[model samples]
Target: MRINVNQTQCGFVMKNGCYEKMIFAGTYHYPACMGYKVIIEEMRGRVGFKEVPLKVLKEDAAFMSRVTMVEVPEGQLGILYINHAASAVVTDREAAYWNVWEPCELRFIDMREPVMDRNVEKNLLRLIAQQYYKKIEILPGEMGLLYQDNILTDELGPGTYYYWLYARDVLCRIVDLKMKELEISGQEILTADRVGIRLNLTATYRIADPKRLVETIKGVENQLYTRIQLIVREYVGRYRLDEILEQKEAISGFLAQRMREEQEQYCVEVQTIGIKDIILPGEIRDIMNTVLIAEKRAQANVITRREEVASTRSLLNTAKLMDENKTLYKLKELECLERICTQVGNISVAGSGTLIQQLRELMGT
Candidate 1:
């Protein structure tokens, strides 16, 4: 029988004027009025394709050609057509698909439940092959790797390799539920205009169990941020305003330690917690300044009083020592005579050495 091929319609017309569409099956030559009858007989014993409609095959070129005519093997779905150009192959497994014709386009549609796993790497590569340029947001419970373009090659240099790994969206969310409960209690200890004073807190987390994350903590990023804010607020509140304001470094250290302990369940690593600022209330700060000034003034008064008392005691002790020493009395008399001699050129003695003795007798000494 004569058959007319139409690329536009993707169909064939027999000499009897009956039209049959190209389907996903091995080439078959059929007799007039028996369109696709040979192909139907060939697929009769197959499991998945046994009763498959011929019309369905014509619409899906990739599925028709790429899939095996035999039943689909366990653990693998029948190939699905993505593009009409017959370039790409999509599978139900892992929401993954690839473009063998283009050999560059790939895509991983996130139609399945969230999962954190290594399969993300495979899915990412597939997405890149599909030529999708978009940021794949991984929630708190989701973790996976995604390649940008189909640039994954062994010939890539070290710099390019590093870039690919860094570019991958492999973040995870670690929540602090305890901190949230505390916040709801409204018992904040350290109330600052800001949180985590002087501490630089950075968290590094990867999807340890992608499936678990997707199922349990599906939207983790927002939750993690909320937990962090709460944790900082609660822990900071535990300290006094003075501690936060003056001991920022100490506060930061404590926060880092606390965060590490709290975030362990999410398989997160708190790389570092840095204290950045210690915010203080204006009123409390003013009171502290006043108290400090008053304390300094009191200390100065005490020192001044002690010095005055010491000086007076020292003068009185020196006077008592002078009065008790008989040798000091004689020395004083000699000093008086030397002073008189210096003032006058010479001192006249009434009776030689006995002058002072005669004066003492005259004075009834």
Candidate 2:
């Protein structure tokens, strides 16, 4: 029988299904009486010496020199590097690769400990199967709570973390520690005056005690929202619509103080409470506009009447002064004549009577 192998492949010759020699690219002829056969395999990737055991192949210096052997014992992991770049994660007990194909190196990671080695490149974990390991990343302004098998294991700060998944069921809960806004949008409630008003409430808060918040509070946001709603209702129910509108700042202050008092219970710090908007019903708004217009008109009328009364008093005083002083009266007549002259284009002061009599006629005209 004549067998051929390509340059990128190698062949194994078996004599009567017994031990055989590894052959490279070439042609060879053997007698059929010898029961010779060849098995060809591509040697560009991982080496697969299926026809012969590794112990037997290791004895062949040529075969051993052409390949690299990676032994990954139990409770250990192997990271295979091809040409100085991470290529694959090896979890099996042993693996072999062709050294002639590419430069290969193996790095062993001890799995006896669940925590990943700090020296190991975290990016290399991408090559690992998700079922074999767990990864957690807590960002800035966030905290991570690590749990194993439904039990609290550790509280983790903001950073990347890894664990062996086979040891336990890993779970991480991230809680944001930054300031957050809780907006209760458009809550309709009745005031003491039985006036229905919609209020948009906003509260700024932050997680003060993350551990307590995680252990004690199931739903912190929902509970805090309910508390704020009740507080608003309680305070608003005691005030009339006019009072609420007038004392908006005072109401906000009271609510903030009340929330602060209960901060420990919710494991949150209440920063500020604000009445974002006080929306009145359409009918009430219209009625308020009407009242505002009427009030403004009344005030304007009062101001007008006050100015009129002042003018009349001043006129009476001026009349009394003019009656007592003839000169003052004459001066007043001249002032009136000057005003009348400004209005007329020409004044015909007929050589008639005195100038005062002429001015008096002009004033009458």
**At residue 361, what lDDT does model 2 achieve?**
71
Number of the top candidate by lDDT?
A: 2
Which residue runs of candidate 1 sit more than 4 Å off their true CA positions?
Answer: 1-157, 161-225, 238-251, 265-267, 326-365
In terms of lDDT, the poorest run of 10 residues in model 1 is 153-162
Tell me, what's the RMSD of every candidate?
16.4, 3.9
Mark the 10 consecutive residues where model 2 has the least summed lDDT.
356-365
Alpha carbon lDDT of each predicted model: 0.45, 0.87
Candidate 1 TM-score, C-alpha based:
0.34
Alpha-carbon lDDT of model 1? 0.45
TM-score of each: 0.34, 0.83
| Tens-place lDDT digits, model 2, residues 249-329 | 999999999999989999999999999999999999999999999999999999999999999999999999999999999
Candidate 2, superposed: residue stretches over 4 Å from native: 6-9, 15-19, 30-36, 42-44, 49-65, 83-85, 100-103, 348-365
